[model samples]
Target: MLPDGMTRRDLGWAITGILGVFFAAMISMNVVVTALPVIVSELHGTQIQYSWVVTATLLANASSTPVWGKLADMMSKKTLFQVANVIFFLSSLTAGFAPNMETLIGARFVQGIGLGGLTALAMAILASIVSPRERGRYAGYFGACLATATALGPLVGGITVDTLGWRWCFFVGVPLSLMALVLVGFTLRVPVLEVRGRIDYLGALVLVLTSGALLIWLSFAGTPEFFDWISWESAVLLALAMVLLVFFVMIERRVSNPIIQLRMLVSRTTLLAALSSASIAVCLFGMPAFLGQYFQIGRGLSPTESGMMILPLVLGNLIGTMTTGRLITRYGRWKPYIVVGSLILTCGMFGLATVDSGTPFWFVLTVLVVVGLGFGAQMQNLMLAVQNTVQVTRVGQASALIAFFRVFGGASGTAILGSVMAMQVVGVSVAEVNGTAPSATYADASGTMFLVAACLTLPAVVLNLLIKEVPLRTTI
Candidate 1:
């Protein structure tokens, strides 16, 4: 930790450097969403291929998180930050120059590896330096940066695709990442924990394979035309994933220093925090992906217009997160926010389920703002709750575990919702052409998707109610 009574500038530089890397990585991931349709159409890739473009990154991210977190615990955070930034920069360049959809997708996978390191390591480092009470203020700032980046990604991506090309969206992240690298090199300093231990190569491999297989299964589950539940290929892949996952658990149990500590997961706080993180991920990531599509396909809006319409959600998120941060610092309790946020989220989602092709744009915007507020209030609070509960030594692992589940949930949620939307559209089209009475040009699938999302969050609300609030730590 920095010397006691460090100047505000010292704090400013550290926070800025960490948040810069986070903003760059998050913006790069989100920018592609609005540009996806244009990118796929230009490259002649199918919708399934388009979905994989996002899923591939998420898969790499989820698999690599524990590895990065372990490395952060064992090595210099400065070294890891530099390495992650360099990898991110190179991958961004490669993606910008990718000649085909396949190459772009491959570049995104590499980018995700770099991003996983930066995000998990950055958070771990911050938590190490700050008291839990003060950490929320900084976490709030980080949340604001994330909200801003997410909000701007689609708008900037739309403009780039319209004027220059979709490739520039990838290029845009390079300078930001470079800036982060420079900031870390100049301003950030943390002692490396030197340790001699064998890396868990087998555990890592099994975990990656298991996660990749599950993601592939989800991606192609309903779209592959052979949704045959009893297919030999499906059974084989499913069995392989389950067996590998079980082996990974066994390996973690035996390792001297596991990549992820399975013991922490048994704690009620950790388990509930992970579940809450996953539920929020499903709500946060699933909505934006489909909202862009809804605007373009269902309502015939341009990419730029669709992005502009979603700005209110971002604004609400910024306000809610910052406010919650101050409130948590003042009250020194977190459970209330979780319960209240989930209930608000449920209400917003229920409202969203009634949206249709003829629904007013204002109504849709209002509901999204409500959803964003709920997210801002709950997302970081859950992580903080988990971080406060764990001892300092295991903080990195605990934090990474929470983030890992959140990303995994997001990836699975997007694939699941996309599949639902695809089936709904197909069913509507088939029925319409078969002489079924049709009053509308096309059925809106967004409402149905929101209903399913609401159902998923209902359980999360119950889980939140059970979370007991522990007092904020006063010292490290």
Candidate 2:
């Protein structure tokens, strides 16, 4: 039932407002993908900085996600959402005018903090107002918006970079965010209840430290100037990360309101879905980060052309998610879709693993379609399954925990895969110098990156297989 005094029209407007925020956030997250090459070159950045530019944002988003989720369970969701939007707007504007790569990255990190809140809170608010059974259709709408923003990101970013310059890529989201903020202020209405729960400040700190240490280790592991994978630096960093993780676990167990609720993992479904979400993210986030380099640098395509080439993936994502979402709601069957999606995703990753600069455009487009379809079908539905297991009161925590895993995995995987590609490029360069290879290109290294992604994704298929399908709950 609708809350007292709430009408369906109110709900529709609220959803529109929510989607606007989501659309703007997604655009900010993805607009840099195609433009990173130009951005790095103009700022005189190295390969490591190229990856960190993306990694920094993912790390910030992942680290802050649980806290945002926890807060939604305690505070006014509407107020928190606006606060996040404002943060995103201000940070995006700062990033647009940044004169150096370091400043851009710092701004991106702050931007990520806002993205984290918007991401976790959107689902929490939806759960507060809609039942899981009905949520599937709305989730489909969310997925469509996501696919659209994701689709437009590369194209718009390419055009912006090609014509107006790279700075405009960041500026484009400012107005969109402002529009969302205004719409949400006028339309979004949820009861502010008198909930009492302490924020887990200590746990949040330990979690950030742990994730930061691990990412640092991954990003610089084999870079000769920094340290080797097996050197003393790696050992110290890894040990520190592990110790912090242990502390984080201990803190969570004792805290009144832990950032991540350990109790949720005890559920078999939640555990598997979390694992699968993390695994799937390695490909979902990693592919776009590298594909621009593959098309532009390796294959000698312009940013505009690369953006046009990526259309198949986004189109497939739109088709897959929209189709499966409605099907799940209609037939009340979700597990089969997830399992099948996992298989398709795995196959696509393996197929991409074989691609090189010389690969035919048609073959690349076909594989991208498969990959997009797999991701679209799997991403939101996993959250839907987890949200089904929790009551409305705890939905924020449950939903955010799953999002944490997804972003965490994406950050880690991006760091590792980016390092792998960087190292591969170095090796190929050396081989070219010694006359052992004819060329050194990101196209060659990209195959190795996708191979690693495929290996990581292999586990998700098994994890999803073990998830027990539960009937969708009918009431809030």
Candidate 3:
């Protein structure tokens, strides 16, 4: 049931407000994409450092997502969303004024924590107000927010870098966040369920450390300055990550209210959704992180041109999402969309695997459109499928868990693929002899990165085929 006394119009306004916050959070993530090469070169950062800049945020966001979801179940989601917005606002300001890459990375990490809260809270809020059957239509809007923000982020980042400066990329979100804060405060009205639970502090801490260790291992290992992949340091870090993961699993099993409920994942649909989400994330998160470098460093395009180049991808995503969403709601059959979407995504990835600096732009752009269309059809729909299987009261946790895996997968993909790219870069192995530089090396190396990413999506295609789609529930 919708919240008592909440009309459809009220819900629309509330959803609008929620999408605004979601847009701001997502836009902040991508705004630096087009400007990253410039930012890193000016700051004198290495390729590893460049990867860390993006990985840090994804890691922080992934780690904190479960905690935020658990908190929403026990408190007021509207209030939590507002608080996260404020945190994002402050972090963006700090990032804008940062004097060095290290400081900017630190700020982005904190911003990701806030982003975790916003992402989880927005989905929870939607679940609370909309039935799973009806949510299919709204899911399109969520996808639009994601795609639109992604689309605008690069264009805006490009324009900001070309005209005002790259610093303005960080400042751009400030006003949007402030506006979302005000809109949400006035329009959002949802029932806060009275639930009793303790926050899983130890579980959350260990999960963070575990992911951190694994990412750190991926980021620096194999570089000559750091320990090689076969070295003792790699062994130690890998071992530490495994041990902490075991501890985290143990804590979840024993906690009164686990950050991520182990039992919920036992369901076939939920499990498949988690796997599919992670697999899709490999391409969704990993590709764009390097696309900027591919165009600017490899093809020698300006930030603005690179930004404009991606418009087709975003456009395809926008249409696919909005169209698939309405079809799922109208027909009440979601499996076919995902099944077909995954195949298309897989095909698109392979197509991209062949691209290099010298590849024709028309062919690359066509493949991107295909990839976006496939991804859009599955991304939010996977969560919708999972939410259908869970109880209304557990929606917050269920949604958060899927998101956690997606973000974690994205983080892992960024680090692992980044390491793959770094290894391929011409001077990385000989950086001591010749200083690191961003050059045509990225152009030559990008194909291997996309090939690796393409291999990762194969599992997603298989997993989506395995998912048994239960009918979406009509009640919240």
Residue 442's lDDT within candidate 2 is 73
Q: What lDDT, from 0 to 1, does candidate 3 have?
A: 0.86
Show the colliding residue pairs in model 2: none
**RMSD over all Cα atoms, model 1:** 3.5
Candidate 1 per-residue C-alpha lDDT over 419-469 given as tens digits, one digit per residue, 9 for 90 to 100: 666556653332222123322333367788778888767767988888878
Count of clashes, each model: 0, 0, 0
TM-score of each: 0.94, 0.96, 0.96
Q: Taking the tens digit of each residue's C-alpha lDDT, what string does model 3 give over 1-476?
A: 67887877777777887888789888888888888877887777788878888899999999999888888888898898899899989999999998998999999999999999999889988998889999999999999989998899888888999999989999988877888887788777878985887889999999899989998998888876577999999999999999999999999999898999899889999999998898889766667768877877777788888888877778878888899999999989999899999999889989988888679999999999998998999999999999899886888888899999999888888998888888888374212212233355677788888898888888888899999979888888
Candidate 2 TM-score, C-alpha based: 0.96
Q: By summed lDDT, which 10 consecutive residues of candidate 3 come out lowest?
A: 429-438
